[model samples]
Target: MVIQKKVGFISVLFIISMHSWCQQQINLVDKFQNQKIKAVNRSITLYGDQRDAIELNAENSSGIGIIEDLEFEKGIIEIELLGENNPGKSFIGIAFNIQNNDTYEAVYFRPFNFVAEEQIRKEHMVQYIYHPEFTWRKLRSERTGIFEKGIRIPPDPEDWFKVSIHIKENNIEVYVNDLSEPSLIVDRLSSTKSKKIGVWSGYGSSGRFKNLIIK
Candidate 1:
């Protein structure tokens, strides 16, 4: 009886240790593989307890981070974003072909309240635009257009949302929350090739991301 009890305890301990190690491995892979672009100062630390955490500032343009620089011609990219303090005005989403520190094409998801004045009058919805020339003025309509239309993954303010994007030739498809069909698709937009991927956060809002897989 004593021998059996000891063996059972050892087995349980081994399983727990294995599970913890696997989780650490996944986190490490996401950290080392992606190119981090912070709009604010950031830090990654591991304590003696063998646990790790990444910290970032929520203000300024310090909340942006990029995973991969991809080609705009053809391919698919997906990301899982965990939002913190998403109040109604917070914004978190992906940007492509970031030419400079200030410009790129972004597909963003924010609450209806955060919609810009021009966007508010036009349509109360999420946005996807080609921000050419690095200014909001250069925003050109793409797949979804000015009207707000797409799946709304309920904002938990403390939870995460899975966003997936598919770009093939001149067609673009966006999906939120593992829906069967894409929520937004833009047919063609001048046929320009691009290849860059990153994440961004606004002045007061903050977001964290993981499980970024590309194919």
Candidate 2:
């Protein structure tokens, strides 16, 4: 009888330990920004190669060499981006809604300089593209529902910026590092749920992304 009790106690302890470890792993996925990620590959091309970074050319096209496979039933996507290049008319940000191995949609931010004014403006923007269809549409000003226009979250050009995007059932929230509130929020989207995720760039921009986490 005593031997059975001892065995039962050991089993209980092992179960508790396993539960604790599982909880820790779940928390790690839930809060992805807090972990270190090694780069898997560079540029999602037919030939897979690992490079240090990616560059964007003209005609609004550039992509990270590395691709992460993630599914977001409902949660947040977070990343750290390091920006570079000059004469800055470029779009850089995270992407989702990838379909058919050839097309996807993205929400990107661009740095712009006004002709009349001397000030530089960072454009917080969103775009949807159905590739092969090659249809690209902007999701600012034209679309309604809680979108703040002309808001700038300045990029350091040399430092990493923590960008967090929260996607709930009916809302989207975007934020930069150390900011208590989101820089942009939209309460309504044509589709509130998505699974695919990626990094993107466009038109004369170069950048690096690291520490990507999706929950």
The lDDT values for all models are 0.53, 0.50
Best by lDDT: 1
Q: Least lDDT summed over 10 consecutive residues: which range in candidate 2?
A: 39-48
RMSD (Cα, Å) for all candidates, in order, is 9.7, 8.7
The model with the greatest TM-score is: 1
Q: Which parts of model 1 are misplaced by more than 4 Å? A: 1-56, 61-63, 68-73, 111-125, 132-147, 150-157, 187-194
Q: Assess candidate 1 and give its TM-score to the true structure.
A: 0.59
Tens digits of per-residue lDDT, candidate 1, 155-177, equal 34456667777767776788877
- Per-candidate TM-score against the hidden true structure: 0.59, 0.58
Question: Candidate 1: deviation at residue 37, Å?
Answer: 4.7
In model 2, what lDDT does residue 74 have? 54
